[model samples]
Target: MTAVPTISSPAHLSSPDGKTAMTHTPLRIGLIGAGGISHSHLRHLLTLGADVYVYSEAGAAELVALYGGTVVDSLDELLAAVDFVDVATPTFTHHALVKRALEAGKHVISEKPLARTDAEVDELAGLADELGLMLFPAHVVRFFPEYVLLKEAVASGRLGDLAVLRFSRSGAFPTRTPWFADRALSGGIIMDQMIHDIDIARWVAGPVERVSAVSSHAGDATTPVEAAHVLLTHSSGAISHIAGIWGPSHLPFTTEYSVTGTEGSLAHSSVAERNYISHLASTDAPSGLLPEVDPAENPYFAELREFTDAFGGGAAPRVSAAEGAEAVRLANAALLSLETGQPVDIESPSAQATGK
Candidate 1:
C-alpha cells in the first residue's frame, strides 16, 4: 500500500494586466478504473498542475499510495469531489460509469469506443449533447508525433491520393484480468484491438465505405469472437486491410500501420512504439542517431491535458465523442461482416448515423 499524496495550491502568477493573480488552483479530477492504463493516467496526472482523486474497485489503494492522492470509497463521493472524471475501465463497463459521471454534472473523458454497441454510443452522445458537457474519448494516438507526421505526409500530398492501407496489431490475451477472455466483455479482437486501426483508417483516409472480415478461435474458446482479419474500403477510394491476432509471441502487442500512395509511402511498426521509442532516432541523415533525452513524450498525457484544459475552459475536444462512436460503428460493422461472412457497407443506415 503506497501513500497517496495531498493536493497543494501553487504560487500565484500574474497576467500581463496587473489584476490580482489567479491562484494556481489545480483542476480537481476523479479517476475511474485502476488497471494497467489507469496507472499511466495516475502517474501523468501527478505531473500536471492539477489536484487529483481516484475511485476503483481494487487498485485505488495502490494508486492513492503512489500519487499521494485521496481515494474515495464510492463513485458518488468521487463524482461530487471532482470537476471532471476519466473512465479507464474495461470496454463493457465504460458506458455506465461515464453516464453516471455525466448525470452528476461532471465533465467526462472515457477510454475509446464510447460503448460496446452503436446504440450505446448514440445514447451517450445524445445525453452529452443534452447536458452541454464535454465528453471526450481517449483516442490518444491522434496526439502521437508519428500519427501527426503520417497524417501530414498524406495530407501534404507527399503520399498522393492514398491508394491502400494495411494495419495490424497483435498480442497474446492480456493477463491483466481474466475478463479479457469473455467476448461479451471484451468485444473480441475486432472491437478491442483492430478498432485502433479502424479509427486510424477512417481518420487518415476518410469514411469507411465497406467492411469484410474472417476470424478463428483457439480450442475451448467456445466464442465466435476471436482473432480476425478484416478488409475495409473508404469512400475516398482507399482500400485498407487489417490483421489482428491474439496469442503468445516474442514481439507481441505490436501495431503496424502503412499507407501506400501514388507518390510514396511510410510505415510505422507500432503506433505505441513510434510514439514512445521512434522519436529518439533521426531519419534526417543516414545512420540516424538517438538523443540523450527522448525529447518526445507519451501522447496520452497531452491528450488528457487537452481534455482537462477544455473542460476547465476551452473549445471542442480533439477526439470528440462522436468520432469515438464512429470508430465503434466501424468495429460493429466488422463484427457484422464476420458473422455473415460477407462485406458490409459502411454507408448503411445503421452506420450512417455516426456522421462519418
Candidate 2:
C-alpha cells in the first residue's frame, strides 16, 4: 500500500466566501515514475483517500488532471512535502530512490526486488532497522483473495501434506514504458514477472531448496529476457513447476494454480474469463466455489491498510524486507540454473556458484 496523504478537495467548488467544507488528513505522497503500474497505485491511493502528490519526468499534468492533485517537479520538493513516498520507478533505480527517501526520514513502500543484489537489499534492510522506520515491499499477490485462501488452506492442513504445486501464468505483451524491455533496468521477465509466482511458491510450499529453469528473450529484443519455465524443490519435500510467457491474446491475462496433497487436490484458475476455485475430495467427487468479484474494490487496499497498521503499531510488515530479499535470491538462482544447465542452490551466497 502507498503511504500517501488524503486530500479533501472542495477548492474549485467552494463558496465565494473563500471557505471550503471538507476534511482530509492531507498525506503528502511523493510518487516516482508514472507508468502503468503507477496508475494502479495512483487509483488505489486516491480510493484510499491519500493526498496525492505525483512525481514523474512527464505525465504529471495528465495524472493531476485525472486525480485532482499537484505534481512536484523535483525530488527535493517531494521529499520536503510528503509524509511518505512511493517508488514505482524502473527496477534498477528502486534501491537508490528508496535509500534516499529513508535517509530523508520518510516511510517508504517500494515496488519490488528491493535491489538487484542481496548485498544492496541487506544494506537497505539494515538502514531501515536502524532508523526505526517502515519499509515494505510490494508483493500484491499475497493480498489476492485466492492466494489468501490457498495459504490458509495449506496452513490449516486442509490439503494435507503437499505433494506437488504448479503455476501457469501468461498474457499478451503489456504496452509498457521503454524501460521495461531493458534488461539492465528490469532484470528481464524472470524477475519482473515470474518472481511473483516464485514468491508464491515459497510462501505456500515452504522454503525452496533448489531451482532449475530455462529462459528466452522477447523475440529479438536486446533488453529484458521475456519468457521462462522454472522448476522448484521445497524443503518440505514438495516439487513445483512454474511457467510464464508473453504470447497470449483474446485474454488480458491468465493464471492457474494447482496444489496436490496426500488428502486432496485444490485447483484455482483465472482463465476462461472466470475465476474458479475447486477441490477434489477424492478421485470420484469434486466441490468448488465461485466468489463474487466486486467492481472497483480489490485486495490492494487491504494490503495498504495492513502496511499502515504495522507502521502505526510498531510491528513488522506482513511481507518483510527479508522476504523480498529472498524472492530476489530465488530469482537469481533460477536465472543461474537456466544459464548453467544445473540445479541452483537457493542458499548459495556467491553469485558465481549459484550461476554455475
Candidate 3:
C-alpha cells in the first residue's frame, strides 16, 4: 500500500477564526465531458469554488448554459486553460484524454475503469510519474459513507478475520448512449458496474488469488439486460461472491452486501427497512445503527474534495492509479473466467518472475 502524505495546512488558506479561508484563488478545472455524471461533478466543483471550463464533443452549449462555465471548442484549448482536467468521457476515450492531459502538465481526475487494458493504465501511470502530475481515478465507492464505515470496521478488527464477503449491485440498463452496450467500449457489465465491488473486495479482503464467473450476456450480443455472478478467492483465504445486474430501463438502482468474519458479521441492503445491521461476538464492539451520513453530502463531492486536498498538499490520492489498474485487471480476469468457464488464476509478481 502507498503511504498517504500528511495534508499540510497551507498558510495562505488559513483564517483567524480557525475556519478554512475561502479567499484563495479557486483552482481552474476543465471538465472533459458533459453527460449524466458530469452534472454531479459540475455541481460539486461549483460547491468547491472551482473555476470551471467545459469541453465536450456534444452538448457543450447546453452544459455551459446550465452550469455557467466557459465552453472550449477543442481539447487542447481546455487543457491549456486549466490546472486540472476531469475526464468524464466514455470508457474508450479515457486513455487518450488522460495521456494528452498528463503530457500537457495538467493533473487528472478520471472516472473509473481507468482504461480498457492493464497496459494502457500502466502507460498512463508511467507518463503521470514522468511528468510529475497526479493521475487520480474516481473510484467513488471508496468515498461512500457505508463502505468507509465497513472498511473501518474491518481494519479495527472488530469483525475479526474476514472469511466471506457477498456483494450485489444492480441497476437499470444504461440506454442513453449506444456505446455502453458495446463490449469493446464499455467492457460489458463486469467492467462497467461490477468493478466497484471488485475494488471494494480487494480493498477489504486483500489480493485476489483466483476468479470464477458466469454471465448471462457473455455470448449474447442482442441481450439488453446484462447480469453476472462471480466468485473471488482472496489470497488471505477470504471468499467473495459478487452479483451484478443491469435490469430493464424502469428498474431502480440497488446495492447490498454482507461481510462475515470469525467474530461477527456486518450487512447492508438498500431495499431493506433497516439498511445496515451488525452482529459481533465481543460485547465491546458497537452494534445496531452505524453513524448516519449527512443526507446533503454527496460521495462525488467528497471524492473531489479529497482530490483537491491531495493536489494542494502534494499527497497521494485516496485511490491511486495503481489501485485503479488492479481493479481493471480483476474485472478483466472475471470476464476471462466468464468466457472460459474455468477458474482463472491471478499471477502475482513473484510467480511471474519465476515463470510459475
Candidate 4:
C-alpha cells in the first residue's frame, strides 16, 4: 500500500493576486473498517469531495480498488495522515477506535450506538471536549427525507405536542458476519437494530423518563429469529412504542413509523417506497442489516458532508456526540427492562452532568 502525504501547515495560502483568499482542500479522511455499512459511506465520501485513505486489515485493498481511494497498510499510519477519522467498524471496537482517533487530535465520525455503555460514551465526549475536537455519531436516519419532514412537522408546532410515537423495524438476521447474533458484540437486536427509532423518539417527542420491554425468540441455533417491543414514557408525557425483529432470512428489510400528536399524525412505510427506493444490486443484499436506499440521494452522504463541513468550522451537525450517548443510554435501559420484565427510569443527561 502507498502512503498518502498529509497537508498540515499554515492554515491559509495566498492566491495569485497576493490577496488572502480562502481555498478549500479536499480532506484526507481515514475510513476504518471495510465491512457492510462502510461501502455506503465510502461511495458518498468520494462523491462529496474527499481524499479517502482506508485502513482495513481484511478488505482494505479490495474496497479501495472498487471505491477509488488510497489504501493504507496500518491504523497508526492512516491516523497520522488523515485530517478526520470515520469509524465504520464493528460495535465492539467503536469505543477504543474513536478514543484513539480523538486522542490523535483528529475529528471523528462514528456509526450509531456510539459505545456499548453510557459511561464509555460520556468518556469519549469528555475526551473530545478537552482536546478541542469534533466527535459526531453517524445517526443517518435524521437526514432521511421522510424522517426530516416528520421532524419538521413536529418542530413547526403543527403536531401540537406529540402524544404517541410507534415505530417498527424488521429485517433478516445478518448471518454473513455471525456477529449480529452475539449480544456481547452487537448489543442484541434492540441496540443494534432499534436504536434508530429510539433516537427518533427522543429527537421528535422529548427525553424519556421510563422504559418497559418484552421479547420473544424462536428458530435454529444459528440465525434464530427474535422480536422485542419497548415502551418508553417521555418527559413531556408522551408514550413511544418501539418494536424490532431479526427474522428468518426470507424477510425483506422493512421499517414503518406512526407518530400521533394532539392535532394530527404522520406515518410512513418502506413497503410504499418499493418503487422509489433502490435496493442493493449485490448478492449480499438479503443478508445485510440495513435496507439499501438510493445511493444518489443517500442520507449517509448528507450526514458525512455535514460532519466534514463542521470539521472545516461550520455549525454543528444535527446529531451530536452527547445525543449519541443518550441513544445508547436508552438502548441500555431498554435491554435492562427486557431482562427484568419491569420498567426502568432514566435520568436526563443534563441532570447527570450536573450531578443531580
- Tens-place lDDT per residue, model 2, 112-223, is 8777766777788778889987788898778777778888888889999999999877654443456656556676667877888888888888788889999776544322
Give the best candidate by TM-score: 4
Which scores higher on lDDT, 1 or 4? 4
Q: Give TM per candidate.
A: 0.82, 0.80, 0.85, 0.90
lDDT over C-alpha atoms for residue 200 of model 2: 83
Candidate 1, residue 27: the lDDT equals 77
RMSD values, in order shown: 7.6, 9.0, 8.8, 5.2
Candidate 2 ranges with C-alpha deviation above 4 Å? 1-26, 217-226, 248-251, 272-296, 312-317, 348-356
Superior by TM-score: candidate 1 or candidate 2: 1
What's the CA error at residue 77 for candidate 3, in Å?
Answer: 0.7
Flag clash pairs in model 2.
Answer: 5-27, 5-50, 5-51, 6-27, 6-51, 183-224
Per-candidate local distance difference test:
0.75, 0.72, 0.80, 0.83
Candidate 3 lDDT: 0.80
Instruction: Give a tens-digit lDDT track for model 3, residues 42-155.
Output: 877776777789999998889878878789999989988988889998999999999999988988999988998878988998788888888888998888878888888898
Positional deviation of residue 250's Cα in model 4 after best superposition, in angstroms: 2.5
After superposition of all CA atoms, the RMSD between model 4 and the true structure is 5.2
303-323: candidate 4 lDDT, tens digit per residue: 877787787677778888878
Each model's total of backbone clashes: 9, 6, 0, 0
